[model samples]
Target: MDLLEAIRKRRSVREYTGEPVDDAVLRELIEAAVQAPSAINQQPWTFVVIKDADRLAQISRKAKSHLLKASLSEPAHSFREMLNDPDFDIFYHAPALVVIAAADPTDWAVEDCALAAENLMLAAYAMDLGTCWIGFAQNWLATPEGKAELGIPATYAPIAPIVVGHPRRPPPPVPRKNPDILWIDAQTHCA
Candidate 1:
């Protein structure tokens, strides 16, 4: 698919078919991810692919538990109920999880990883695959126990915990908001 088309149509998929995603396809998505631009060419991203159904479910459970105990007073109330639910799979039963990480906690690492993640997500959508970046897993995945369980390195930071799988159905397009522009020309006076 064309890059712009992918950009416009790509959605954060929640429902997924239970079929396993091919390794080659995952590799292709990672290759596409690495092609993304990085700050000062740090190219600091690392990946951990978890295709084990048991493990993804385990992580999902742990993540939900962790989020439930966290402070969910007001804004976090949005997730309070779902996290409390016994059957809400954080990964939505996706067959693959491609975790994007940063080797070092540098200033630009998160930004760089975010760009790579966007690339990976777009590539998945273009290939008729669905992907969702699970933010609920981020905090737990950063903990020592979470790292040990996933075999993630001690110093590495889990930037994006994305689940990849076949979509149960095509997600309807969500409308985008118009950009709030502040165009400043040479003739415009400084504030």
Candidate 2:
């Protein structure tokens, strides 16, 4: 797929076919992720691929519980309702999850990992695979128990918990808002 097409077509896929993502394909996606530029070329990112069904279900349950107990903010409230529901899987039942972590908790760690995540997502889209960043899992995955379960080092912080799988169907194109560009020429800047 063309880069532009992939960028435009990359939707946050919530529903997956539960088909197992091949190990080779997952490795290719990781390779694409690491190719993303980082601050000062630090490349301070590590990945934990979770494929075990039991582990995934356990993480989903724990993360949902954590979200339910969090403060009742706008988004949290919405997620709380989802947690209340018995059928909703926080990971949307995707077969594979690629947890991106920052090896060093620098100021730019989150930003650096986010860039890599975008690369991974786009790469998956190009390969006809589906991916969704499970932001709801972020806080839980950073906790001591979460880290221990995944064998993540104490210094490394989980930056993104992205689920990867085959889409049950192609997601429709979501409408895009107009770009809010504030272009300023040299003369305009000087003025």
For this target, which candidate reaches the highest TM-score against the unseen true structure? Answer: 1
**In model 2, what are the clashing residue pairs, if there are any?**
none
lDDT of each: 0.93, 0.91
Residue 45 C-alpha lDDT in model 1: 92
* C-alpha TM-scores of all predictions: 0.97, 0.96
Tens-digit lDDT track for model 2 on 80-137?
Answer: 6678787778889899999999998787989999999999999999999999999889
In angstroms, give how far residue 157 of model 1 lies from its true place: 0.4
24 Cα displacement, candidate 1 (Å): 0.6
Q: CA shift at 45, candidate 1, in angstroms?
A: 0.9
TM-score of 2: 0.96
lDDT of 1 by residue, 21-47 (tens): 999999999999999999999899999
